[model samples]
Target chain A: MTSSAQANVSSPVRAEKPQRKQMSDMTIRNLFIAPTLLLLIAMNVFPLFYSLYLSFTNYSAIARKAPVWVGIENYVNILTDPQMWQYFNTTGKYTLLTVSLQVVLGFALAMLVKEKFAGSGIVTTLILIPMMLSPVVVGLFWKYMYNPSWGYLNWLMGFTNPSVAPDWLASSWARKSVPGLALFAVVFVDVWMWTPFVMLLVLSGLKAIPDYLYEAAAIDRASSWFQFWRITVPQVAPLLMIAILFRTIEALKSFDLVMGMTGGGPGDQTEVIAVNLYRKAFLGQWQTGEASALAYIVLIIIIAISNLYVRYLNRLREG
Target chain B: MATIELRNIEKRFGETYAVKPFSLTIQHGEFVALLGPSGCGKTTTLRMISGLETVSGGTIHLDGANITWQKPGYRNMAFVFQFYALYPHISVRENIAFPLKAEGMAKSDVYKRVDEVVSILRIENLLNMRPGKLSGGDKQRVALARALVRKPAAFLMDEPLGALDAEYRESMRAEIKRLHLSTNATTVYVTHDQVEAMAMADRIVVMSAAEVQQVGTPADVYHAPANLFVARFIGSPGMNLLAGPRRGEKVELPGTGNIYTIPAPQREVLQAATPEGKNVIVGFRPEAAMLNEQGALTGEVYATDMLGAYKLLHVSFDSDTVVHIRCDRMVSHPIGARVRFDLDPQQVRFFDATTEKAIGPTQSAGTAPISVQAANAQEKAA
Candidate 1:
C-alpha cells in the first residue's frame, strides 16, 4: 500500500477535458465588474490626471487655445506670490480655530451623552441634525441669519441694547478694528455645521469601553478624577485624534460656507485657500494653471498631515 | 485582613428585585464563595460586598465600621473581574502598581510592591509586556498581581477563572488557594461552577433565584444539603432523586411500580417530618449507591459510561425514573442489562415533596421547621 502511494505521488498524469463554451469564474467576475471600473476611471481618474497636466502649463478657460508648456512657471509664480502666502495664513488660522473648537466641543458633548438617560436617544438624534443637512443649505440659511439689519442674531441682541448690534458678515470693524471677527463669522458657521460629525465619532469610541474597567478602577480606590485621566482619556484619545484629522482637512479645503456667508470679504479678511483658488480659477483672471498648482500644493499638505495622524493611530492601536 | 458583615442586604432594579434580603458574615481571613447558577444573585451579592453596587435595604459593616453608604473607592477592596479587566494600555508592572500609585505611594515603594507581587504570581518575566500582548493565563496572573499588591480590606473575585481553559483553570484554582493561604486576605468569590467553590472556598453559600439556600463548609454542603435546590445543585450530574409516596416502611415510586424499603432511622425521620399520604423524595449521590447481588431495588441498565477512574451505570426503574450507580472501572454493564443496587442508608437524605426542604437528621441542628405561611411566601416571591 505504501509503495503504491509513493508511485502515485511520483507519477504525474494528465487528463483532457471536453470542449465547451462556458466562461471561467474569473472571466465572469471581471465581466460583471467592468462597468463600475470604467465609470470610475472616466469620472474620477480622468479629471485628476487632466488637472495634474494642466498644473504645469499656461491654461485659461476663456483663452480657447491649446495650453502651452510653461515648465513650472505656474508653481513658481504661486509659490513666490505674497498674496498666496496671505491666503495660506488665512487657511491655517481658519483650520486651527474651527477644527480645535469642533474637537473640544464635540468630545465634551460626547462625554455628556455617553450614559443613557430619559429622552437621550431623541436628544442625540436632534444634536446630529445639523451635520446631516447639506453644507450649501446650511450656508444659505446662515447667511440670512448673519444679515446686519434684520438678522435674528442682531434682533436678539437688540433686547439688551438697541444701539450696538455688531455687524456679522460685512462689519467694517472686522477689517479695520478686529480682523478676527471677520474670520469668526465664517468659523462659527463651519463649527456649527461640523461639530456633530466629530461628536458621533467620539461617541462610538466612548461606547466601546467596557463597564467592568470602571468598576475595577472603583474597587482599586481610584477617584473619579483619577479614573477620567487614567481610563476615560486614554481609551478615547485615538478616536479623538481621528476626528481632529478629519475636521482639519475639511476646514483647510473650506469654500462653500465662506463663499455664502462672507464671500471672502470685508476685503480678503476670510479668503481661505480654497476660496482663493476658486477666485483665481473662475472669477476674474481665470488662471486655471496657477489654481491647479495651488490645489496640488493643498493636497500634498493634507496628505502629509494625514500620514502623521495615521502613524499615530497605528501606534495607539499597538499600545 | 478585615471581617465584612452584611445585614439584611437587598438590591432592586426598578421594581424587580435582583437580590432578596440576606445576611452573612465573613470572618477575617476566611474564604467564602457565593455559588449559584446564572442570574441567581451570586454576582450581585459579591458586587454589594465590594461596594460596586448599592444595597437597597440594609447596611454593611467592614471591620465593625458602617460602610454601607461609602463609595466603592473608599471601601478599600479589590475586585478581579471575569474577563480580567486589566487596563489594555498599561504594562503588567504598571497595572500591578495602579492601586498602590492611586494611594499616593512613593514611586520606589510602588515598584518594590509590584516586584513582590510579580514574583509571587511568577509573572516577573512579563513585567514590561502590555495586556494586549499577553496570553489569557498571563493576563489573569497580572490581574491577580494587581489585586494582591494593595493588601486591601478584602478581595472580591467574580468568576475570575471562568474564561480560562480547563487545565489553566485547575492551575489557577490552586494558585488562588495558595495565595489565600499566604496572604490571608478575606476573600469572597462568586462562581456558578460548584467544583471551583468546593475546591477553593472555606465556606460555600448556595443561592437560587435571589434567595440563599444554604451556607456551609464544602464537605457539609455536599454530605448534607439543606434543601432540594442545594441537594441537586452541589454535585456532579447532581444528586439522583426518586419521588414517591410513603407506604408502611417503603416508598412506592410513582409510575415505576417499584418499592424502596426505607431504613429504620430514615423512616422515622420521614414519618415525623411529613404527613401520611404525601409524597417524599429520596436523595443520594451517585457514588453512594452500589451494585450488589442481594440488593432489593432492581432496574434495567439504560446506559453505561466509562469515566476513566470509575464506571457509571444509568439504570431506569421506569420510563421516567432513572438513577446512576458508580462502580469500579473494571465493572462493565451493557445497556438493557438487569441490575440491582443498594443505597448506603448512612448517606441517604429525605425531602418533603411539597416544600422541597430537607427532612432528615442531617438538617442543620436547631433549625426550625419551615412554617406553611413562610413556604407560601417563598413561593409567591419566586
Candidate 2:
C-alpha cells in the first residue's frame, strides 16, 4: 500500500518529467534555429508574398498613385499579348535545347574524366573554371568570338569561303541565326563549366558500385554495352535525374547570359521571358504589377520542377 | 554437372603472385573448400576456376575441355560473391531471376525458377523488396538463390557467409550444406574459417602463401597435416610442436627434460635419420599431451575458460611451452596449481628441422581425448 502511494506520486512525475524535458529541448532548438528561419522568411518569403500581391494590383512606378486592385487584368493582358507568348515560346525552346545539349555533353565529359587518365585532374579543373567565372564575362567573351570580321569561329569557317562571311549580329538572318547561336554559345559554356559537377556526382555513384558487381557482370558474360545499359545506367539514373533537374531549373531561369550577350537584340527576336519581363518592368514606364505577376509565374514553374526533384530524391533515399 | 580440373594455375597481379602454380581436380557433385587465411590465394584460385581472373600460366579444364581462355559464362559456372553483390535497384525476385534472364530464359521459366528458389530460401515475403531493404542473412540467401537459379556446371562461392552474424552464419552454413546435398552441383567454396570448411566441404584444400599445403577431407587435414604450416594452421588451439634432440629411441625435449620414445615401427627411421642428440621438432595435439598421475612433465595452470561442452586450460611448464588442454566444463583448477601431464608417444608425429616436413612414422595420433583420427580414417576411406 505504501509502494502504491509512492507509485501514484511517481507516475504523474515520470509522465510530466519527459514532457518538461521535451519542452526544454524544443526551446533550446528554437532559440538557435528560429532567428535564422525568421530572417529567411523576412527576406525571401516576404518579397515573394509582396510580389504576388503587386501582381494582382496595377502598381505603377511613374504615376505615384496607390495601386488599384485589378485582379486578373495583368494576367489576361500578358496572356493576350503575342510578344509575351513569343517570349514564352523562345524561353521554352532555349531551356529545352540548352538543357538537353548540356546533359549529353556533360555526361560525355564526365565519362571521359571518370577514367584514370593522366592529366584528367588538370582537365577537370580547367573545365570547371568556366562555371566559376563571371557569366557577364562569358557573354562578353562570346560576343567578341562571334564578331564578323576576326572572330575565331568565323576565321576558322572562313577557310571554306574566300569572301562570303555572314555578319553574326546584323540582318534578319542574323536575328534568327544569332539567338540560336547565342543559345548554343550559352549551352556550350554551361556544358563546359557544369560537366564537372555531373562528372563528380556520377564518379561518386560509380565508386559506390563495388568492383565485384562488374566482376559478377563479367562472369555473367555480359557484353560491355550490356553492362553499361544494365549496370552503369541503372546505377547512375538517380544521380543523373538529380543533375538534369538542377540544370533544367538553372536553364529555365537563364537571365544573366542573355542580358550580357544580346540585350533582347534586333527587334526583340532573341528576347527570352526574363529579358521580356525586365523590359516590361524597368524599360517600359512603370508596369511593376505585370512584372511581379511574370516573376511569380517563373517562381511557380521553378517550384513545380523542384518539387518533382525532391520527390525523386526521396525515392532514391528509400531505395 | 561436370568435373573441374586446374592444372598448374598461376595468377599474378603485377609483381605480386596471388596464386602460384596451384593444381586441383574437383570431381562432379563434390563440394570442395579452398581454406586459408586472408590473402592466401584461396579466393584467387576460386576466381581463376570461375574465369573471373585470367590465369598468367597453366590451364583450366572443365569436363576434360581446356577452358582457361574461355569466358566465365561460356564455361557455364556461376559465382556468388562475398559481398553478395545483388543489384540494389532490383527486387529480390528480379535478383534471383537475373542469371536466368541473362541466358535469355523464357519469362514463364524465369518466374517458375524464381518462385521455386524464393520458397526454398523462404524469402517469399521479401521477393518484392530491394536488396537495400533486406537484412544481411536475407541478402546472402538471395545471392545464393541467384547463383543457384541457373544451375550452371559448377558453383564458385567466395566467403558467402562471411558477412552474416555468427548465429545467422551457422544457420546459413547448414542451409548451404543442405542445398549442396540436394543440388549435387560441383561446387568450390572459399573461406578462412576452418569450422565452416570442415562442416560444409567434402574435401578441403588447405593453402598458405599462394601455395596449397594439403588437400584432403577436414579430418585428414586436421589429423595428418602435411607440413609445419598446416599442422599449426588447421586446428583450433593448433598442434603442439617441441624442438629437441633425439638420442637412440628417445627424443629429448629441451628445458623440460621430457623424453619421448619412438615407437618400434618408426625406430629405424629415427635412428638412420636423426643423429644422436640432433635437434628435431616433435609434433603432437594438445589432447595427446594429457593430465595423468604417472606423467613426465609438470605444468602450472596459466588460464582457464569454460567453453560449454569443454573447458580450455592453458598450462605453462618449466620449459615455457604453454600447452592448451581441453577438459570437461565441470572440471575446475586453480590458476597457480601444478598439474601433471603425459605426452602419449603413440599419438605423436615428428618433423625435420630443415624442410619443416613430416618425416618420422605417424601412428594413431588420435586416441587422445579430443581425437579426430577416426573421422580422419573414415574420410580417407570415403
Candidate 3:
C-alpha cells in the first residue's frame, strides 16, 4: 500500500514537472532565492568590498578627482597618528564603561524580575521603554536634562545644595578638574538606554531554565547563595555573554547619542571612534580613504571579540 | 533514617485545593510509594514533604521535631526529579558531589562520597561526561546517585524513571528497589505506574482527586482495595466492574441477565453495608475469572489479546459493557462466539452503588476458600 502511494505521488509530480521542461530541484530553488541573494549582495557585500579597496587608496569626497591608490599609506597613517589613537582610546573607555555597566545592571534587573509576581510584567515592560525609544530622541532629551541651569537633574541636585551640581558638559581640561567626566556623562546616557536590551535577553535565558532544577537544588540542601552561583549563573552565562557581545559592538560604534548630546564637545572628550570617522569622512577634510581604513580596523576588532564569544557559547552548549 | 510525619497537610492554589488535608507517617528505612493518576496530589504531597511546596495548613515533623516552616535546604532531604534535573553544565562527578559540597563537606570527603555513589550506581565511566552526553537511563542513575551521595534523612523520588524506555524503566525499577534495600533510607516515592509501586514499595498509598483513597501494603491494597477508585486504579487492565441489582443472597447482572449467589460471608457484609432494593457493583480481577464448561455467566467474545503467557479475551455482554477474562494462551475463541465464565466466590468483591466503598467479605476471611464455599453452599440451599 505504501509503495503504491509513493508511486502515485511521484507519477503526478513527474508529469507536472516534465510538462514545463524539467528543472533540477537545486536550480528551481536557486531561481526562487536568487532575488534576495542579489539584494543582499548589493546592499551589504558590495559596500564591504568597495570599502576594502578604497582603504588602500587616497580618495577624498570633496576633491572631485579620480582616486589614486596609496598602497597601505592610509592604513599606515591612521595606525600611527596620535590624534586617531586618542579617539580610539576614548572609544575604548566608553565601550568598557557602558558595556560593563549595562551587563551588570541588566543581569541584576533580570534576577529581580525572574521569579514573577504581581505587576512584575508591567514593571519589566516599563523598564524596557527606554531601549525601544529612538536613540536620537533619548540623546536630545538627555541633553536638555543635563543643562546646568534649569534642568530637572540640576534642580533635583540643587535641593541638597546648588554648589554641588558640577557643570556636566564642562571639559575637564578647561575646568582644570577631573578628566573624562563629559565622556562619562555620555556613557551614562548610553547605559541607561541600552541596559534594558541586555535585561530582555538575560530574562529569556532565565525563563528557559526548568523550575525543577531549583527545587532539586533546594532539596539538596544548597543555600540560596550557593544555588545562585551553581545553578543560576552557569545556566545564564552563555546568554549573558551574548548580551555583553551585542552591547560591546554597539558601544564601540556609538555615534547618534554622542552627536545629539555633545557633538564631540567639551574639548573632544566625548568623541568616540565612529564620531571621529564621521568627522574625518564628512566634515572638513572628507578623507574617505582614511576613514574607511579606521572603520575596517574597528570591524576586525569587533569580529575577533564576537568570534571568541561564539566559541565560548559552543563550549557552553556542549557541556 | 528518620520518621517523616505529615499532620493534616494541605495545599491550596487560590481557592481550589491541590491536596486536601491528608496525613501519613513514614517510618525510618521504609519504602513508601504515593501512587495515583495525574492531578491526584501524590506529587504535591511529595513536594510538601520535601519543603519545596508550602502547606496551606498543618505541620510536618521530622523525627518528632516540627520543621513545618523550615527552609527546604534545612529540611535535610534529597529529591530526585522526574526529568533528572542534573546540572547540565557539570560532569556527573560534580553533579553527585554537589550536595556534599553544598553542606561544606571537605573536598576530600566529597570526592570519596561521590566515588562511592558512582560505584554503587555503576556509572564510573560516565563520571567525567556531562549530563548532555548521557542517555535517559544513565541520566536517571546520575540523578539517583546525586540524591544518595549525601546520606540525607530521607530520599524523595518523583517518578524518576518516568522518562525512560520500557526496558530501562523495568531495569531501573529493580535498581531502585535494590538501592533502597541496601541503603535502608526512608523513601517516599511517587509514581502513577502501579507495577512500579507494587514491585518496589513496602506500602502503597493510592490517591485520587487530591484525596487519599487507601494506604496499605502492596498485597493488602491489591487484594482488598478499600474503594472503587482504588479497585479501578491499582491493576493493569484494571478491575472489571459490573453494575447490577441485589435481592437478598443474589445479585442480578444487568448486562448478561445472570444472577450470582453472594457467598455467605460476603452476603453478611452486603446486608450490613446496603439496604434492600438497591444496586451493588461487582468487582473482580481478570485473573480471578475463568472459562468453564459449567460457568455461571455467559457473553459473546468481542476481542482477544495474545500476551505471550496468557490470552486476554474481551467478552461483550449487552451492547456496551465488556468484561475481560484471562485465559490460557492456547484457549482461542473466535469473535462472536458465546463463552461462559465463572468467578471464584472467594475472589469476588462487591461495592455499594452510591458510596462505591467495598461491601464484601474482608480480605482475611475471604482467603479461606474451602470453609467459605461450604458455608456459601449451605446459605444458598437455605
Candidate 2 per-residue lDDT, tens place, B92-158, comes to 8887887777778899999998898888878889989989988898899989888878777788999
For candidate 3, what is the DockQ-based docking class? medium
- Give TM-score values for chain A, per-prediction: 0.89, 0.81, 0.86
Could you tell me every candidate's TM-score relative to the true structure?
0.91, 0.87, 0.90
The number of the candidate with the highest lDDT is 3
User: Clashes in each model (backbone N, CA, C under 3 Å)?
Assistant: 0, 0, 0
In order, the Cα lDDT scores of the candidates are: 0.85, 0.79, 0.86
What's the C-alpha lDDT at position B178 in model 3?
93
What's the CA error at residue B345 for candidate 3, in Å? 2.3
Off by over 4 Å in 3: A1-43, A159-164, A172-176, B255-257, B360-382
Clashing pairs in 2: none
Ranking by lDDT: 3, 1, 2
**Model 3, backbone clash pairs (residues 3+ apart or across chains), number:** 0
Put down candidate 1 lDDT per residue, A139-241, tens digits, no spaces: 8898888776667776775633433556667654322455568789889989899999999999999999999889888877888888988998889889988
Query: Residue A193 CA error for candidate 1 (Å)?
Result: 0.8
Scanning candidate 1 chain A in windows of ten residues, the lowest lDDT window is A12-21
